[model samples]
Target: MQQADIHAAAQTLLSRRLNNRMTGPLKAECRPNSVSDGLAIQHRLLELMTQQGNPVGGWKCALPIAVDGLTDVPVVAPIFSDSIYTTSPCPIIADEGWCKIEPEIAFCFAQDLPHRPTPYTEQEIVAALSGAHLALEFILSRYLQPDSVSFIEHLADCLFNQGLFIGPEISLEQAFQASTIELTLTTASTPEVQHFAGKHPCAEPLLPLFWLVNFLRQQGIDIKAGQQVITSSYAGVIEIAPGDYFTLSYEDLGEISLAFTQD
Candidate 1:
């Protein structure tokens, strides 16, 4: 297929995937084999999303992942403001699209790191963040077997993110002082609870933040003031089953809960 056709088809697929949040395998033709193709598709999808009037309020990012010994660049994408909610019993799914919960940390920027010539220093990046909080990223994929999707294909799918839920804020001092968290993930319908200890993949939680600052600038995107930056998940991925009431308690940071109706 021509490059234009590839982007157009992928954009349409992404629009449907976001509009319905439907759970199923993606159409084979929309899959892109290379990261360059995926990036082209991703940006086209972003444009399509904005044309629909959903403003970009923030972004979610993760460290680079090695796929078959070749390290993929970090995953990054805009987070729609409407999709974000404070800790509450919010409805997650209805007619379609499955949700995955990932425990994570979020930083709210106080200063805008607009496209600039000079690279931002670690101190500059940290200073740009006004506060920190615990958050659960609500992930969704067009593919039913998301895990089986190729790395490039997954990157094109907005890194499998659908929405974000931000908990109460914690002081930056408190945030940087800790590196590990004791997490408890609970599903209300089954009424079962599981506990696990998880830590930041990077020794310093701010490493990804700093990397993101520079990364965005390089891409000609800026980290604006009052916008949030959600780092990678701390705990592993947990797919939200039908009728599941989800709650995540992060050690010392606080907790957030979401209630879902079965589709």
Candidate 2:
């Protein structure tokens, strides 16, 4: 895609986010047809958001998934600073009267890992972390019919991320050991508590961070100090009504509680 096309696509996405609205896929002239094109649009979107005062605070990433004969590259999206909440009663723009959330572990960096030719080892990546935290990723797709769009289109929109809620910190050892957590979810609006043997898609949360650091460096982007990285969800996505207080407990690790109010 040309720079103009990239800007156009990014502008459309930024507009939807600012206006708290959703639309169909981008127009043909500005649509991304490849991973590179999608990433270009994503980069442009981040620039636009930063220009509007919502700078990139962190990122969300997952290991690649293979299906049939094709394998996907790892997925990534920027998490804006303005969207990360450190307190409860988190405000959100609900989709149709409901909100979607994902439970995950977040790793915060203590130092900058600037772009380099050499790959960052797992130990080096871990050494740069300040600590781990329990987090909830708020989801809100810009596309009205998300399923109708291509993977590239979804990628360009930061993989449906709307915001993030950072909760309590946990030990690095505890975070590493949390591959398979027995999850229990309780909500104030419902009597029944939901339980699941939550499993991380990549088995370990740090796997994606290791990949993310290396991937961004290759793109001439640095993993700056204080930025948090949230790996793939452990218990998948859960839908809850607005105003419902919910608590997610990860067996032996930690728990986070919050309520989503309509923005």
Candidate achieving the largest TM-score: 2
Q: Choose the strongest candidate by lDDT.
A: 2
lDDT of 1 at 65: 71
TM-score of 2: 0.96
**In order, what lDDT does every prediction score?**
0.74, 0.89
Candidate 1 residue pairs that clash: 21-97, 22-97, 24-144
- Report how far off residue 122 is in candidate 2 (Å): 1.9
Give a tens-digit lDDT track for model 2, residues 1-263.
88999999999999998998898889999998878898999999999998998898999999765522436854999999999999988899887668888888899999999999999898998899999898889988889888888877888999989999999999989898789989899999989999988999988778889999999998888998989899999888888888999888988777888887889
TM-score of each: 0.86, 0.96
lDDT of 1 by residue, 85-199 (tens): 7846654653243566788888899988898878999998888888988887877666667677787777777777777888878889877765788998787767678887777
In model 2, what lDDT does residue 55 have?
90
Model 1 TM-score, all chains together = 0.86
